[model samples]
Target: MPKLLLLEAMGNTGEYILDAARHLNAEIIVVTHEDVHEDWYSPTLKAKIAEYGKLVFADFSDSEGALRQLKELARAEGVDGVVAGWEFLTPLVARLAADLGLPGNDPTRSLSCRNKRIMARAFTEHGIPAPRTVAARDLGEAYTLVRSAGLTYPVVVKPSEQSGSWGVSVVSDDEELADAFVVAQSHIFQMPHGIPLDPHVIIQEYVGGTEFSIETVAVRGAVTPLFPYDKFTTGGAKRAEYGHTVPAELDAAQVAVLQEAAVAAARAVGITNGVAHTELKLLPDGTTRIIELGARLPGDHVVALMRQARGIDEARIYVQIALGQEPVLTPTADTAAGIRFLTPPRGGTLRSVTGLGDCDAVALSKMTVPPGGRVRAPGDNDSRVGYVILHADTAAEVNAAAAQVLANVSIEVV
Candidate 1:
């Protein structure tokens, strides 16, 4: 069996990667910190690892030390490929892959895929259509930069390196800027692995438009853009992703426009192999602006959604690329899939959730938190109580089904 090494196995992507490994009959070994494995891993994830993979401990915070250990392990085990399981570890994965003479991204430009500060610079350099952004170390500096750059009110403020929309906020005026900056810089170290993050924060001109995500799979510098998806987010001062529908309602020409921009963004970031998840906004003027792109699989169960909607397993494709093999990109299904997050009405102890039984199109529903658990206020993605997956024959059908669930589902919190 071919051996594969994954840098970490604690996120949502880990389970999908494990399932893909089984499909390929590959022996997948997960390398992670011991504390992370013990603290962050769920029971289901732990069981999956035990049954389908092996575990190796390494301190990711010690970058040089971890690289040395991973290099030795990759050689000792004759590992055929190396992949990253989290956004924070993408740079490390690229470096490791290059060190082993395997197909991977350019280590020099890998940071641009993770850090917004560097990403903005890369977009500017490549002439990629993106928002005007400025990084700030303090609120005063952020204000100065915003005014100096001619950025008006109602701007976006977010951490340079965080993911999942954590610490992302929209400031309507200067008074809210201070608190937004504090929240953006709150998390200095990423959980589980304790990876240090950039202390600065990025404030950008708000790109007003409809948001969508397009994924691309690159093999040896050749890019193949996949179906675009509608990215639904909550409005107001804070942006939280509420859901997404695959094969976003668009004509052939519209899809072409998005695909071209996404491919350019991927190339600009030096993604010669693996996948790129590019989030862009379709403006009212019919132009597209890239919000950000990550050199990893589209998160939030998008891999599974793609499989259900298009009969394409993105997780499997990622593994194939890591193994330096051609990926199967043909679509076998003309369907649609969506996921809606369950956000409580208020921040309090969970009581009970009901009304899901009446929703017919819900293929699967999962509650992340149990009864009596403390839930946060609905401002960001962290406030989600659970999620429901929906699948149907078309995007409209899936969207209508999701609407019914969102309208009927009731969660009583106090």
Candidate 2:
């Protein structure tokens, strides 16, 4: 059996990857910080690892030390491939794979894919159509950059290294910009691994249009764009993703435009191997602008949606690519799927979630937080209480059904 090494298997996508490994009949080893494994890993993931995989410890806080220790493990265990389970460790995975003479992305430019500040510069240097962006270390610097660039109101402020829309805000004026800057700079270190973030915050001109995400799989520098999906987000001071509809309703020309831009963005980030999740906006004039890209699989149960909608196993494809095997990307079905999140109306102690089981269109529903658990305000992805996944024969059917399912669901919070 081929041996695969996974770094930090404790996110929304981790279990899906593990299931893929199991289905592939591969021996899997998980590398994670001991503290994080104990504190952050879900009960289900822990059980899965305990039953089907081996757990190894590493200190991710020190990059050099972690790399040396991981290299030693790779050699000792005869590992076939290295893959990341979280965004923060993707750069490390690239470097480790390159060091071991395995197939992976370019180590020199991997950080550009992981850090927003570097990503903006990469897009600019590569002439990729993206939002006008600038990084600032302080509020005064942010204001100065905005003034110098003649940026208008409703600019976006976000952390350079965080994901899941944490500390991301849209400001309409100077006072709001100051507040947003502070929020953006709040997290200097990521969780679980204590990986230090780029202390700077990014301020970018907000692109206006319908947002969508396209997943691409790159095999030894060959880029193949997968399905493009519609991203439904809540509009306010903070953008919280509410749902996603697979195989978004777009004409062939529009799909081609997004695919072309997505491929270019992936190339710009030096994604020669593995998968790239690219987000972009389709402007009113029929032009597409890149939002950001991750050299990893799409999150928020997107893998599941893809499989249900198109009969494509993206998780398995990712594992096959990491193992240096040819991926099976042929679609086996032509359906549609969607996932809608359930959030409390206000931040408080959750009591009960009613009417979920009554939704016939919902294929599955799972609550991340337990009863009496505290839920955050509907702002970022973290505030999501649970999610429901639905499937139908078409995108329109799935979307409408998902909306109806959400309409019947109610959360009692006090």
Candidate 3:
């Protein structure tokens, strides 16, 4: 069995990875901070580790120190591969894999996969079609740089490195910029490990269009961009991802356009031996803008959705890629699946959610938080109170089923 070191098993991706690891019968070593393992890890995650793996705590806040400690553990444990369970720790995982001479992406260009500031620069250098972006350390500098770059108002303000759409905002003018910049800069560290983040905020020219995501798999520099999928997000000052539909309804030419852009961005970020979850926008004129790429398995339960739609187990493929093995990327199914997040009308004490019908297409449906649980408004990914997964014969059918659920559901909050 291949021994794999999984960095930070915290999200749904972590659970999927663990399941894949068990299926592959790989020896898994999960790493996290002691505090995080106690406070952030779920009981189910802890149970998974207890069943077939070992857990190790490291101070990820100190990158160098953590690297040293993990290096020793990896050597002693005879780890054959390294995988990133959290998007924030992709860089560290790359560095570890490269140092150990294992299958992984290039360490030199790995930050482009995680840090938006560095990723913007990398995209520009590669001539990837992306939103024009400028980084700012403070609001004063933001004003200077944005104006100097000839960027107008209504730009996007986001932290240099973050997930879940946290601290991401669409600002119209200078005052809005100030507010958005404060929120962006306040995200100075990542959770579960307290890893320090780049304090710069990225001001990007807004690209208006339909947004979609393409999940890509690569091995030894060979990239295979899969079909595009619908990535739904709320519109307003804050963009929050509400749901996703797999096997996006697109023509052959349209899928070609998205696949071409996705492959370029994945290779640009050094995804030579791993999986990438890339987001992009398709303009009315058919042009596409690469949003960003993550060098890890996708979160938001996209793994499960993909498996249901295409019968491709991306989490398993990720492990195989890390172990220097070729993955079977063939589609075993031609169905479709979608997930709709239950978003409260506003933020308050959750009272009750009703009207979820037991439809045949509904594969899974339940509330993540119970009644009386504190729930935030639909601002970011974390604000979701529950979700429903549905599968059907086609994308249109799946989308129609999800729409029915959305239309009938009522989220009551005090």
- TM per candidate comes to 0.98, 0.98, 0.98
Cα-based lDDT at residue 211, candidate 1: 99
Q: Evaluate all candidate structures by whole-model CA lDDT and list the values in order.
A: 0.92, 0.92, 0.92
- Pairs of residues clashing in candidate 2: none
Q: Cα deviation of 60 in candidate 2 (Å)?
A: 0.9
Residue pair clashes in candidate 3:
none
Model 3, span 135-154: residue lDDT tens: 99989999999999999978
User: Could you report the Cα RMSD, in angstroms, for every candidate shown?
Assistant: 1.0, 1.0, 1.0
- Per-residue lDDT, model 3, residue 335, is 97
